[model samples]
Target: MKLYDYPPAPNPRRVRIFLAEKGIEVPTEAVDLRQGAQLSEAFRRINPQCVVPYLVLDDGTGISESIAICRYFEALQPDPPLFGKTPLEQALVEMWSRRAEFEGLLAVADALRNSAPAFKNRALPGHDDYEQIPALVERGQRRTKRFFDVLEERLAHSTFLAGDFFSVADITAFVTVDFAGWIKLTLPETHINARRWYETVRARPSASA
Candidate 1:
């Protein structure tokens, strides 16, 4: 199996951290997003979506989405379960993971992609180039601020995003929070619970990946 990855990108980092947590090492090839390598014909053939963190199974089956790739690995090694152990636990993890992605991660991406000069014509990911929307930048900024409050309330009661156990929800939330730094967004100083949880997760060895 081979993992096509790009460093420092939030989506790819999620899978890298997942691999680290599972103590699994697969041959990895860097797909340089900054240089538009993902847009090449060769990469497009591997993943029509042309996204990084694309995983190719030994049989040549390709998986694109970061969470989907993580799920594949979770199925291969179930001991240190990152998704969930029970059915109800799995649902909870999925719920919170979706929330983290849509509410937190997307918001940060929208703000950064639409407002940052670096993104210019590449507002959205994939092979196609989409122009930035100034309106979305303001909306994203507001959503990002609201996301911090939501996390603060949730983390105040739960040890992790999904519940007691550290699951994929925590991973998504961690990456989202960290990625927000790129847009100069931050967790409020008053969000003590969120800050505490963030610090604990940041200290994990997998976070360095």
Candidate 2:
């Protein structure tokens, strides 16, 4: 398998952590999104949508999007299972992963795309370009705060985002929260459970990936 990667992006970092946790190291081709390399014709052929973080499996099956690539890795290496060990656990992990994708990742994207000067005319991740709006930045800030609250409430009760075990949900939330500074957003100091969870995740071997 070949993974199209970028060094600083959170989405790709999630995949990196997932692969490291599962002890999977597929050959990789770094796509420099900062240089707009993903928009080139050659890269577009790999993923018609032209996104960084594409996975080309050994069977010539090209998978785009972080979550799909994560699932592919999970299926290939199920030991030390991040998704789950049982049917119910799997469902819970999926539930929390989905929530993190929308609530956590999307909020970060909103904040960055709407606020960053470099993303002046780019709101969505793909090629479509739209004018940035300061109002959207404000809204993103509000949304991030809401997500932090939701995560704090959830973490206050459970050790991990999905359940007692670390899963893809935890990785997703970890990267999103770790990069919160880019968007001028942050995890609240009063969110003790979330803070504790963050510290543990920081110590994971996969986290350095």
Cα RMSD (angstroms) for every candidate in the order listed:
1.0, 1.3
lDDT of 2 by residue, 1-209 (tens): 78999979999999999999989888888999887788888887788887878988779898888989988777877887999888999999999998988888887788888877777777777766678777877777788889899899999999998899999999999998977778777788999999999999999999999
lDDT per residue (tens digit) for residues 15-45 in model 1: 9899899999989999898888888988898
Per-candidate TM equals 0.97, 0.95
Which residue pairs collide, candidate 2?
none
Q: How accurate is candidate 2 locally (lDDT)?
A: 0.87
Candidate 1 residue 73 C-alpha distance from true site, Å? 0.7
Task: Please provide the root mean square deviation of candidate 1 (C-alpha atoms, Å).
Answer: 1.0
CA shift of 135, model 2, Å: 2.4
